[model samples]
Target: MDEQTITGSTASEIAASVRALHERGALRTGDALPPVRELAAQLGVNRNTAVAAYRLLAQAGVVTARGRAGTVVAGVTAVAQEGYAPDSVLRDIGTGNPDPRRIPDLSGALATAVGRPVLYGEPVIDPALEERALAWVSADLPGRPVRITVTNGAVDAVERLLAQALLRDDAVALEDPCFLASIHTVRLGGYRAVPVPVDAEGMTVDGLRAALESGVRAVICTPRAQNPTGATLSPARAAALRAVLAEHPYVLVIEDDHFSMLSQRPYETLIGPEHRRYALVRSVSKSLGPDMCLAVAATDPETADRLAMRLSPGTTWVSHILQRLVLAQLTDEAVLAEVAAAGRHYAERNAAFAARLTERGLPTQARDGLNLWVRLPVEAKVVADRLMRRGWLARTGDEFVLGERLSPSHHLRLTVHDLEDDDAARLIDDLVDAAR
Candidate 1:
């Protein structure tokens, strides 16, 4: 259909009309749409109305803005995922998963959770879990008021948090080479992602300042054991970041502390006490089994209420049974001790691997979290190819990167905490040869 036939009075109506055309196959992918000014004139609407409609379409992933090239019908963008490659025979080392043996047995916790008959009208959060979770999450934030809300996992909490505070096309500052799920979440939500580079000390101050200057509405940070890079925020750097963030008081800051119980590093936050909007999410998937999908988010009252509204009582509340089960494990001294041991185990194994690599001249460090970020002498793709030939599967750093890189990535993120001594040695030898 031509622009003359594309009719709608409001922005939503216009977006809906475009979607209808896309569904009917009338507007094929790559087809350029009329410019905003042209469309507004033709529809007798304000140019801002047309702009909003285009943004709505872009947010829904139905269309894309190509800068000077103009808006065009866009195809689905493929998102990189974590976990095992299907049916791979090679020794897989890229899966960022915690060791299964370390995950506490859930049989007893499950039994304890079964008797509670949660009803539709009941409070969405388990009272016992809330009290304990608040105490646990509140330890890091001493002066602020914190409210706890449970979700399926950290990813779910992030998605809901963004939804509550942001609209389509809102700019969000994300770490460069971010967590895979965070990258996926931002892309699917149709928000513009401004990458803030992360160094050994965590997110760079200059990078965050630049992002704030760009007018980003939200910022997602990892305070400890950052995914892919294992960069934890240093105390001084954390202070610097908080100073930068203070200028943009209204911008929402979300910190995903996914490795809370498993992290070897101490927590440092970007959200200052007077910050207007913020959320801290901690997940049990790493300490508890991933199957036990549970995360507790501590947010300001407004954010909590917004999140709670989305989580409506009988329909979307996280399973009380799961919450209670997590509570049981968190309170049990034996389980807590086991989790602590698991943290030490991961740190030791990763450290050993780093030592071996460093000795071999690769010069890698054993950072916090479940994986080691190793920089190779050569491009990771080339090394990964060579490693595959010798029977190994490793993830290249490029997969976790946000947007384009100035040069090829020479890094690989390896999950060696679970590797046996012999296997680890073999992989090290293979990697060195592959780099050459």
Candidate 2:
């Protein structure tokens, strides 16, 4: 269809019209969409609205933006995901996972969780879990009243939060070196991702400000132990971000504290006392076990209600059995101590590895979380090839970068905290040699 045939006054309507035309064969693959200004003029709408509409189409994978080449019709391509490659024989150090030996044994907690058979129409969150979780989340948040909601994990909580607050194509502020799951979720949901650069101190203020100015409706932040980089938000940085967000009070802020109890750093939140729309989600996956598959979310009453509607009976409730098990372990002093020690163990292991790299002339520092973000002398891809040849698999930093920000990244994110001393030393030698 030509520009004249493209009709609609609103962003959603315009996107729908374009989709209809494409489905009817009036528009084919590789067809160039009219420029934003031209389409806005034709449709009698604002230029920004047309841009938003185009952005929505792009995020949905219906159209691809080729920079100077302009936007063209293209289908969505498959996205890369995180996890182990079951058949790979190389020593895989790229898998960002908690040390399995440290994950608390759930056998004792499981006995307590299995006693009650939950039926439909019953409460989704276990009362014990709810009480404990509320206290856990509220301790770091503002003193204002907060509501709790249970979800499968941090990713699920984030998905629900964004789904409830934002429409398709709406811009969302995400960290530049963002979590893989966050990147995947936003793209699949058809939401525009505005990258906010992460420095040694979490999300940068200027990057966040630029995103907010671009009319982003949501912001997903990691308060501590951010993935890929392992950068935790410093106290001053948190205050700065909160101030920036204060000016844009209506923007929905979602804080994913995925490395909660296992974090060596303190949690510095972004939610202001008076902010209306926000959520703080802490998952038991990292500290307890990934198999637990449960997270506790604390949010404003209205947001919680909206989330509840989406998680209503018979639809998508987190298992109460899982919730109870988590609560039991959280309350058990011995388990809590063990979890505390595990956190220390991770920190020590990563620090030890970093020291080895530094001593070998490749300066590196262990921040937080289960991995080490190391900068190489040359491109990470080159180093990764060398490592693979040496029988080790590693992830390049470019994998976590958004857009062309870190093209040909000179960094590698290695998960060596779980490795034995000898293996760690061997990998270190290989890594240093690979960089050379």
- Which candidate number maximizes lDDT? 1
TM-score of each: 0.92, 0.89
Residues 100-199, candidate 2: write the lDDT tens digits.
8998888888788776688889988888888888889777985767999999998999999999999987989999888999999998888889999999
**Per-residue lDDT value at 338 in model 1:** 98
- In candidate 1, stretches whose alpha carbon ends up further than 4 angstroms from where it belongs are 1-18, 30-54, 64-72
Error of 1 at 240 (Å): 0.9
By summed lDDT, which 10 consecutive residues of candidate 1 come out lowest? 1-10
Per residue, candidate 1 scores C-alpha lDDT tens digits across 163-240 of: 999987889999998999998899788889999999999999999999999989999999989988999999999999
Instruction: Provide the overall lDDT of each model, using Cα atoms, as 2-decimal numbers.
Output: 0.91, 0.89
